[model samples]
Target chain A: MRDKVVTAAEALAEVRDGALVAFNFWGPGTPLHLMRALQERGVKDLTICTNNYTLRADVLREQGAVDAAILLPQTRKIIVAFSGVQQEDSSASVEIARRVQEGTLEIENVSHGLFIERLHAGAMHLGGIYSPIGIGTSLENGKEKRVINGVEYLFQEPIVPDLGLINAAKADTLGNLVCHGTARAANPVIAMASRYTVAEVFEVVEPGGLDPDTIVIPASFVDRIVRIPDDDPYSRERRVEQTLRSVKYRLEKMAEAEAEAAQGGGA
Target chain B: MKEKLTEELVAMRAAKELVPGDYCNLGIGIPLNCAAYAAEGVLLESENGVLGYGPVHDRESLDENIERVDWDIADAGMRYLEYVPGMSFFDMLTSFAMIRSGRLISILGGLQVSEKGDAAIHSTSKDDIASKIGGSMDLSWGAKRLIVTMTHCSKDGSPKIVRELTMPVTTRGRVNLIVTDMAVIEVTSSGLVLKEFAPGWTPEEIQEQTEATLTIAPDVREMEF
Candidate 1:
């Protein structure tokens, strides 16, 4: 078998400007090491396809050392289910808000199901999918609409990205991936949709180490693997710390909202 | 009603609407609370690919050993999810295929519901910043039944059950039922029908707050819970 293990920088070295990148931004499956490498590589005008764009910003904010400046400029457009300011107090990713206002960044806001389905179409080598989800909503603004069996369905084209970035719990030397708990989110689908899939894993074992049944993503779908060092800044412990910090930040925002409401009136 | 129903009570009432063996999708906010009140055999599904999820694992209730395993609690929608015996996880594609197939009943939080059954939940008129559009569109449009759970009025004393939505529509003519702090209403060809009101609240009182014309059910009574 070809050696798939590579450094984060080596794995991401080929990413170019204007490349479409499919990212797993759901929960802990976000490939922060690859993201950091991409930020440092300074590739510009990239289009990111992900579930939520604010998650990376949230993690950086919780870390308190870095800001959105590193990643915002790299992204020219984001096709996602959730984008923009999240709360009444402006608690969401500031970079997204700023870019959207400046008209520098474009957003194609589709429903979560459609977002996944689009990627799935790409992965499965299907031309497109017809669904009733976006029918009369803004999601169907420019999409082809078809009536099948007396039901309106919107035709969504496939989304094939140039690169796919994902994080996983473990990977065999051959690039078979095993996700931990709910962190598996969109990694498996993303792996199949991109031309090159780079997996950043916590551990890399021998070829026969990972159980076949436990491997959610096969080696055939992965092009490269980067093992995150135990003491790396983006290790599991660091992610947990960042998550807790984000929770604390959210609680604080909620408290502040409550205080402001109390000041307004009893109602 | 003498006092508005608590968020938990509103969720409890919404939970009662779910039948056994139903596949349900609960949105963020008030709908997330419904997991606690779910009926037997009602499996909760998340858009991120989890099924048969149980109620939130309160820190107090979680086993000490399990708490040590780092779980991403930043996403409030998934923070409270407890893995059950038959829990299964899949890719987002499969998760959404189940949703778009109209096999799941969606319980969602809404900003406004028009008499025509159109719902506006994604964006608000006051949003000068970028608008956030989550799974509201798909859940509303493709779910077998869309149940909207929200407070009757906004914080500024405006009725959410309006004749027409002032905000951008999330999905057109998709809402099946509207559950609020004051009343439970069903949207039908005739318009918003007042099915049940909270204790001490009359149809007239609910009508006073609702912008849409309400037709009181023939057997309208106080909510059982």
Candidate 2:
């Protein structure tokens, strides 16, 4: 059994250079404190993996913590799927894209289906799995294709990170963790696939404090717990923007409708 | 039909029959207009995470503080949309899940439709491949009934309704209905059946705009609206 308590920076200090790190939560629910701690510890040459590139843009860059990042191509910048603007331009995508173009930030672009399949395969402890998701596309490069029963299957390699960072809303002293809504995307899989895992929780209580059924992430996968007393404003902001940007095109469509209606009425 | 396309859309809305609670999607270009006149109780689900949405609200009244997915200005039609957060590109998987789960009732989009019900929205050339297919593939295979909306004739007077799609298909055998400015064609196991045509357009004219041979319905009426 591992000890349950540690300072966020101390927990992050354990990450070695060139290790692959995966973080839970996209925006604020991410273990920002731990990320910040890692930055302050002067960690370098690390390969960071997450659904998105930046946690809180300000915090990540200010600390200059990340040496490199691995992400899907489509996941590179947050753009309104229709209009193509940086989701919140002032915050992250622009800078990250700039870095990517400058060759400072590396990317590993995977198709939407293939990425989840990779994680699911990693969680299952399976060897590279077979699927036709990337068969003839650009993603097929560096991949092997095999025919079974006259059907072709593309072989995608598994993704396993060295350290997993997650944000838990609640956890017991034994290191079992739980996440609020929308935090489950890559956290559970990352925790299971990583070599070591650390979590930042809003509250750390005695053993048995959290019900067994309520736990989204089990304690057996956790190695350290860091308590974050307050909610993250950036994460909240990301959630709100995500909701808005997703609908921005629909809104524009509405505006077009009103214009037509006005013209029809005038005629 | 001043702006031939816009007038055609209004006609399509009036002619097409919509069932209440049908999970429908309006694709990016042409189908986007369909949402404006969606009948009551018809929930509009966007790939970015909105369901049971209303029409777009006034931009002047927009909240500077509340932004969605990419932190852009969200419209009223977008309110009550759920947010799926994730690592770098993970939210996309969730969005595709919503599409591929066969939960989407109907999907509306623009395209060149083949007789096989294969719809192509990506591009006519291999050079344009990186233009982003978005959720088209997911929606094509996932939605129960896929509808393709486009002009019957291409700009050079070529046909979009083809015997075989010349472009790479987003999905195979996914299209159920094809609504054009001139008529409505449903792809059946046998071939293309002309379900409805606009008032005054002849079967020959419809066939002229189509590369495929069209079979006219005996009781075809001027597309209702």
What TM-score does chain A of model 2 get?
0.70
The DockQ scores of all candidates, in the order shown, are 0.51, 0.15
Chain B TM-score, candidates in order = 0.91, 0.80
Model 2, residue A188: distance off in Å is: 3.2
Candidate 2 deviation (Cα RMSD): 7.6
Which residue runs does candidate 1 get wrong by more than 4 Å?
A: A55-69, A84-95, B59-67, B70-80, B126-131
lDDT of each: 0.80, 0.60
Positional deviation of A146 in candidate 1, in angstroms? 2.7
Of the candidates shown, which would achieve the greatest TM-score relative to the real structure? 1
Candidate 2 regions exceeding 4 Å error are: A5-8, A21-108, A134-152, A165-169, A200-209, A226-267, B1-115, B120-136, B149-169, B180-183, B189-192, B198-225
Q: Name the lDDT value of residue B34 in candidate 2.
A: 69
Worst 10 residues of 2 chain A by lDDT: A76-85
Cα displacement (angstroms), candidate 2, residue B46, comes to 6.9
